[model samples]
Target: MSKVIEIQDSQFNDEVVKANETVLAYFWAPWCGPCRLVSPSVSWVAENYSDRLKVVKLEVDASPDSVATCKVEGVPALRIFKDGNMISSHEGAIGKQGLQDFVESAV
Candidate 1:
């Protein structure tokens, strides 16, 4: 099973912003092709770094409030949160290596 938590706008604060540990919030959409391409990397991070990071995915179309709050202009956006704040973000289809580096930079 995947370690990635499928979250919505209502759960964003509790799941990510208020969490005690580091968070990897993935913003995506069902119709976004790049989202699909980057999904594997996200999942890989979730599985491999579960001990240090909390991974959550929010569908852009379904979670408008979170999308707007995060200022996510496009799909496949990855935001790293720590101490109830966003520390880093990348908007695009970053491959597995890039995702690894991104997460490593925060945690």
Candidate 2:
């Protein structure tokens, strides 16, 4: 199976901040149209890069506690982490290609 992770406030530090592998995260609110539209692309990349990366989807509304701690100011934001450090990110729906490119380069 693919290695995309679903993280919550209880597991944020250990699962995300302290992760040994590259973590690719999407911060999206439930009502975001573009987030829904580009979700398939995120899933595709997650599956495609399963061997090299860890993908995650964080529901901003559901995880308000994490949102505040992580300073996630916008919906549909992408954050890339490797070696327990945030390396890159972008706002809005970056589509599959854009996301794939960013994550691929992040590692």
Q: Highest lDDT: which candidate?
A: 1
lDDT tens readout by residue for model 2, 60-96: 8778887886678877888888887778978877767
Give me the displacement of residue 12 in model 2, in angstroms. Answer: 1.2
Model 2 is weakest, by summed lDDT over 10 consecutive residues, at 1-10
What does candidate 2 score on TM? 0.89
Candidate lDDT scores, in order, read 0.94, 0.79
RMSD of each: 0.6, 1.6
Candidate 1 per-residue lDDT over residues 16-96, each given as its tens digit = 999999999999988999999999889999999999999999999899999888889888899999999999999988999
lDDT of 2: 0.79
TM-score of each: 0.98, 0.89
User: Which residue pairs clash within candidate 2?
Assistant: none
True-vs-predicted CA distance for residue 10, candidate 2, Å: 1.2
User: Where is model 1 poorest over a 10-residue stretch in terms of lDDT?
Assistant: 67-76
